[model samples]
Target: MTDAPLIDPFQRAVNYLRVSVTDRCDFRCVYCMAENMTFLPKKELLTLEELDRVCTNFVELGVEKLRITGGEPLVRRGIMTFFDSMSRHLESGALRELTLTTNGSQLERFADDLWAAGVRRVNISLDTINEAKFAEVTRWGRLPQVLRGIDAAQRVGMRVKINAVALKGFNESELFDLTEWCASRDMDLTWIEVMPMGDLGNEDRLDQYWSLKDLRARLAERYTVTDLSERSGGPARYVRLEETGQKIGFITPLTHNFCESCNRVRLTCTGELFMCLGQEDMYDLRPALRGSSDDTALKEAIRAAIALKPKGHDFDYSRQRPDGQMTRHMSHTGG
Candidate 1:
């Protein structure tokens, strides 16, 4: 076995891996999935043990950061066991970080266990703070429940970051409100531009599209925004708010492309590897995972897939239409 690092064709070292544990989510966010979502059968999904094995292989291949994501990861049964298993790598200093992106629905129940498993930081998805608007956006989510969960996470000493999707007509009014809320709580805030993913029968992507360029300009009207050069191993470009002394991040996929320094890959629950988020190109690893009793074949398959990583994604909204729209829901790929 060669002890070589995982580097993509673009010469970018692949040190970050985001694994989607399940496609099923408790909340049907209007922008993420349909209200009536049909999820993958449980039998088809990889077992928790298989997920740990795949992730361990990546860690061995020089992947230092592992982010567990899902429609909402905490909802998955026996998920803590996987976290416990991965903590061994962290203890050994082989993995630098083990964090997750959640909707903050179940943090009240699992916050202690997550902290015990060595998770220090978390990213919570929240678009609005208004109760009525939150219900309308999440469809089945309760604003109070999520807020309580956030409180629980903080109580357990977890550093929480809020991730909000910048929707034009939906969250345009709450821009300063959300920013102030995060700043007051001492939590970092990142605003993401909506990408053209999935199909909603009535919800139009163009109507929902909100460029971060304009969002930043609006923020500049009230605050002194200064661009920062540091990255947090993700696509968000950050800026510091001088008055509030807080860091605000912008993920502008449409108006600006941040793919030149791409160093991450996503793994689905069913053992599929997506080389690029915007591209349909994928390599199935179930055969290698299930066929061998050893890790040789599985590692080879991962290396081969990484070699095919593309230069960048094609997400454009300048044509007055959702160009390069993906048929797969964002929930399916992992938010």
Candidate 2:
């Protein structure tokens, strides 16, 4: 009998994988996690070898692109070694692309090495241009450091993208300025709504959830917009500004809900396979991956997990956990 992979019940082809190497970050963002956050223990995290093996298995199952994320993937030790081993797959044509999402706190140190390794693109998360406002948002005073990281990343020949999470009464006033800055530098930029996740995710912040739909309308007022010809195989849709030749994208997960075209899944640092970001259903991949390295069991587990993927995320913000609160942090879920 011939062996062929089974598609999900929804018929969406899963071709992208987001791997969170760690849950510890150098900065504490107000919208992402609790102010006093406790990170995962070292033993609970997957080793570089296990990560490499699981990634190879995903490649065998048709996952072509991989994005490394974290509470700051760079903050995790030995990430460079991890990238080195994975780059061979890209070189051997086993993988098409490898990318990263970072706070840009450490980009100045690792960008050149990461480019030489295999990271084709880098998305730096920056919410504001003002120094004090940046500190207020990320709860850290590292904007200058982050800015240097962005410059270093571009200088290393890596394609750069700026990721901004639009929050009301915060950086919303700087939207026009942020767009102009990215456009002048010829970098692709994206704006996403702040997702309410975890027990730390308070309903009060829901007031800060600015819709990208409204932002798009504001954008159309000043620029001549057109559709982009390329697709990164992820959720964000791109529009090209005819005047500046810069491409801007909007990821409105809370407002527009791109679950209809969702073709991705997330693997947490501890090997939990998440089918939907907004749902609690997950397959503990660590169980199948432990000891002696059974590739067969891992593949079977992966197939089973894929079959059970929900058709879409039921983003009912009112849904509450047993503790009378929601409890999924974006950092733990790989953003």
Candidate 3:
């Protein structure tokens, strides 16, 4: 076999990996976990050791950024221990950064260890600011706990960013409030357009996705916003506060597709490697992990999966139709 490493068809080098630790979550978010999901079969999940070993090999193959994701990463057992082990590499500079994307339900308990484990950045999913609305969106999850988690995460020295998924009829009015709160903390807030890939996901939600032009216009009427291009890997359009150093981002998945510069890959909790959110193609990494596949072979497999990455998502093409054709839910893929 040729020893040359593989790159995606777009020449995008795969350096970042988002690993889903579990397919289960504490909250039943309308756009993530379905209301009827009881439990995932244990047999399909990868053990902790297996996940770490894969991560180790991935790091050796030029993966520098690692983000722990899940239905809720904190919900996974021994996450702090995992962070402890992963942090050594980060501290040694073998890994450039370690981060987590969570719902912030259990962050208060794990935030300290996570920061000590070399985790410096955290993304918390907060869709609504209203307590009743939060409860309604998450089925029965407590908004206070989520808010407390955010505060705790900030206290632990992690750069906390609130991820708000803007749906048509839900959480739209709270956009300004979320941005203002983030500005006060000197942190960032990202507003992502709702994708039609979860339980509450459908063509209607995708259609209702607010456009970046519209969001910017609304914000401009109140505050003086300056556009910036400092972020290239992220999928959001960047903007900085005129006076404060705070930044805000808007991801327009419905009105615009960002696959041209997308540099991220997602690994499901069940061990499937997905190249794109809209595409169903995936490479099963469980066998490779179980069989002790070498780095060269593993790299090839990952590249093959990326080669299949769609040119772009079909949300804009199906703007009018409710493309109820998503392969996996966001909770399963660690939204």
RMSD of 2: 2.6
lDDT of 2 by residue, 243-279 (tens): 8888898886655667887788899999999988878
The residue pairs in collision within model 3 are none
lDDT of 3 by residue, 128-212 (tens): 8899999988996998998898889888788888888877677768777877777888778888877777545343554566666
Predicted structure with the largest TM-score when compared to the true one: 1
Residue 91 C-alpha lDDT in model 1:
100
Single out the weakest 10-residue window by summed lDDT for candidate 3.
Answer: 198-207
Across 251-299, the per-residue lDDT of candidate 1 in tens digits comes to 8888888899989999999999998899899999999999997999999
Candidate 2 ranges beyond 4 A from true positions: 1-6, 201-203, 316-326
Report model 2's TM-score to 2 decimal places.
0.94
lDDT of each: 0.93, 0.84, 0.77
TM-score of each: 0.99, 0.94, 0.92
